[model samples]
Every structure is written in structure tokens, then in C-alpha cells.
Target: MSFLDKMFASIGIGAAKVDTILANDRLVAGDEVNGRIVIQGGKIDQDVDDIYLKVMTSYEQEIDDKKVHKECVVGKFRLTERFTIKAKEKREVPFSFELPIDTPISYGKTRVWVETGLDIKNAIDPSDRDYIEVHPSPLMSKVFNAVTDLGFRLREVECEAAPFHARRRLPFVQEFEFVPTKGEFRGRLDELEIIFLETNRNYLELLIQVDRKARSIGGLLSEMLNLDETNLRLTITNDNAHNIKDMLYQVIKKYS
Candidate 1:
């Protein structure tokens, strides 16, 4: 049987049902997550003292040199309602709350899951989990686009398991990886990794790793570049692009 069915059976309530209806399935940071909770009573009448909603996200962890998995609670809300439902009765309760901006994006889309449940003492709780997608603002898109235009292909995007201690408000961090394009460092590097930290300031931290290609006589040489600044924009003009080619030729001339 389904999880809901099993929960209701444990409560001796025959078959309780719960459903959630969201006003808007798509939302963004600083937007309200409005929805209604629907609960259907089972074979007999029951009193629900309260209702609660829990937002959760599943993320990866590292332990013993191996990857571990865990789910974290992002937020919780309690409804101030005590109602009685008769047998074969259905009830709908409305709820509206603001979503935290730091909510992790899942499935390449900015969507998070929320689970709603009823608090009936000594009874199996009826719960429902809903997924809502959030869209980032134009500023966020600008930063992302700039990186992509720089020939930095996305490697992987994930939320860091640790909470951003610097900023107590944010609970997770998003990391993006990119592979450098063939340029002056064509055969001299492997990839670059970027991590976006949470802070009141609207600046992004960039970490670049230069992996050197193996040579016949020498050992591998790797370098890292860390950039922390604001209003950062990287552009490749025709003149500069050509100049880069000249610079590459000069470098080869000196090395070879």
C-alpha cells in the first residue's frame, strides 16, 4: 500500500487522505508560497489539534572518504487551528507563507519541496509533499550569463551541505563548475570551479584551477586563481581576441 494509506491505517482511521493546492506552482525568492491543505476524514470522526508544514531538501555528504546522503529541514510552520472532521468528510484549509531565498534548487529548476501534515494526537499524521519552482531575478541571470559567455561550460551545480555561518540567514550554498575554453592555456589547463557564497554584498567569489598538461621531462604544474570583486564583467573584443592569439604565439616562441 501507499505511504499515506499505511499512515492512516496505523491511526485506525480506516483511510485518511490529504492534498495540497498551490496558488502558484512557480515562485521566486521573496515571494509567497500560497496553498491550501485538504484533508479527508476516515471511517470515524476525529479531532486535529493543529497542522504543520515542513520544507525539506536532500543533499549529499562526505564521510569516511565516501559520499553519504541526508535530508535537512529547511523550515517549519504551524497552523493555529483545531477542527473536527466527521466520517467521510472533506475539509480544506488555506495557508500562505513567504519562501526563504536560500532554498536549494533541485532538478536544474529552482524548485523546492514542502510537506504538509495534520497533528492529531496518538494518530498517524496525513501528509503531502509538493514541489514548487522558483525563478531567479534578472541580476542573478546576468551573472550566470556572463560566466557562460566566457566559454565556461557548467560541470555540476549543487548545494553545499554546511550552513553559511557567515550569514546566519542562508542555510546552503550553490557551487558551479566550468571547463576553460581553448585559448592561451589551451593545453595547459584542465578546468575551473566556481562557488557562490551567501552574503549581504552582491559579489561572487571565483576560484580557478589551472591543471597543466604532462610534459616529457618535467612534472605537472597546477595553479589556482581566486577573484573576489564587484561589478565584474569579462568581455572578449575582436582586437583583444586577436591580441590573445599573438600573446599565445609569443609564449610558444619562448617555451619551445
Candidate 2:
């Protein structure tokens, strides 16, 4: 190769490009995502050291008392080992990975996407980003329906930096916020916040926080300090999906 050709490829001019095609972009949490990576060679041959995929999302973090969104990887996987593409070559590699069960749903400002990248020595790495729509798992879907059934409206949803006690495999947690509009707890509780802690084919685990309405000056002060919030960890199984509304009502009522 000529020196000019190498220099141009190193700067990503006439360098190999990559694109990812997903079989289905709309899927529920825990589902297997199938896709293929397409690499198209440019004017010169290139040796790729490796191929990688990252499941990415953003979360709100308070830096200097200012809330800003930052990117975080939920999962990463490898597609292939070192490979060489000849000039003007076209290559396709199939790949599949299980979506992390705790992946934040594409609700509110939360977005999830797959990032495919090619690692090249002494050359700019080319990457492709494809956004996907993730839905709640079956049992988790039931939980949301139950909350709405109880006359609660989804007010806001966001993925926030996880507290030390709540951190799992991920540094952040997706929180679903709800407000009582026409229920018994409407006058008693201020709001409800829920986080999906874990999920499996058989069950869904959740951390629920109940914010009660302040009744006095002391209560108001406690609320401001986040002391009046009650946290509960509940697990709903496939068997409980049918009675989720009553089960949720009973549990939340105890706290509200």
C-alpha cells in the first residue's frame, strides 16, 4: 500500500465501515436479540483486531449539584476474533445476545441502543449505533397494569444513579414514578416510586417506595429529609400475576 493510502485509511477516509442489522428491534426485557454485522471494505485492505457490541443507555447523574445525562453500558459481547477484509470486500457476521433483564425500558427520556464497533490497529475504529425498543417483562407488565388499575397515573420515568445499597450489576437503576389520581391512597400518599431489582422467567422482584402525605410540621420535615418514605421489596411470581392488583393494593395500603 502507498504511504498516502495508509495515512488516509488511518484517518477513516476510505477505511472499512460497519453496520448492524437487528432481526427485531422491538423486544421485551430478557429476550434474545438477534442481529448481523456487515463490514464493507473501502479502497484498501484492512485487518480488524476484533469486533465488539455494547448495549448502552443513559442515566441522570448529579454532578456539582447539576443533573446531567451520562452514558452507561448494560452489557458487552464479542462477535469475532481478528479478521482481514480485502479491498472492496463485503462480509457479514451473525450475532446474538440476551438483553439484560434489568435494562431500562424505552420510556420517558430513557433510550437503549446497540453499539457495534470494529477495533483496528493504528486506525480509527468505526462504529454503528442502532436504537431498540425494550418492553417490560410479562410479570412486570402485570405490575404496571395493576398500578394503573388502582387509579394511579405514571407521572415520570427515569434511570438514575444507584445508591450504594441499591447497586447491582449496573451502576444505575430505572425508576418508575406514579401519582395517585383517584384511589384511596390519593389523599394519603404523595407519590410512589418503583424499581425493578431483578427479573427472571418465573418471577419479578421490585423495590417500592411510598411517599406519604405530611400531616404535621414534623412530618413535613421528615419528608424533606426523605425519612417519611417507606421502602418495600416484593416479588411477584407467574402464579400471582392474576391477583396482582389485590396483592399490590394490600401491600401498598399497609404503607400508605
lDDT of 1 at 87: 67
- Write the residue-wise lDDT of candidate 2 on 55-127 in tens digits: 9999998999999899999999998989898879999999999998878899988999999999999999999
Candidate 1: where is the Cα deviation over 4 Å?
1-9, 12-15, 107-111, 163-171, 182-189, 199-256
Best by lDDT: 2
Task: Please state every model's RMSD to the true fold in angstroms.
Answer: 8.0, 1.3
**Residue pairs of candidate 1 with colliding backbone atoms:** none
User: Each prediction's TM-score against the native?
Assistant: 0.70, 0.96
lDDT string, candidate 1, 133-159, tens digits: 756543445545655554545667765
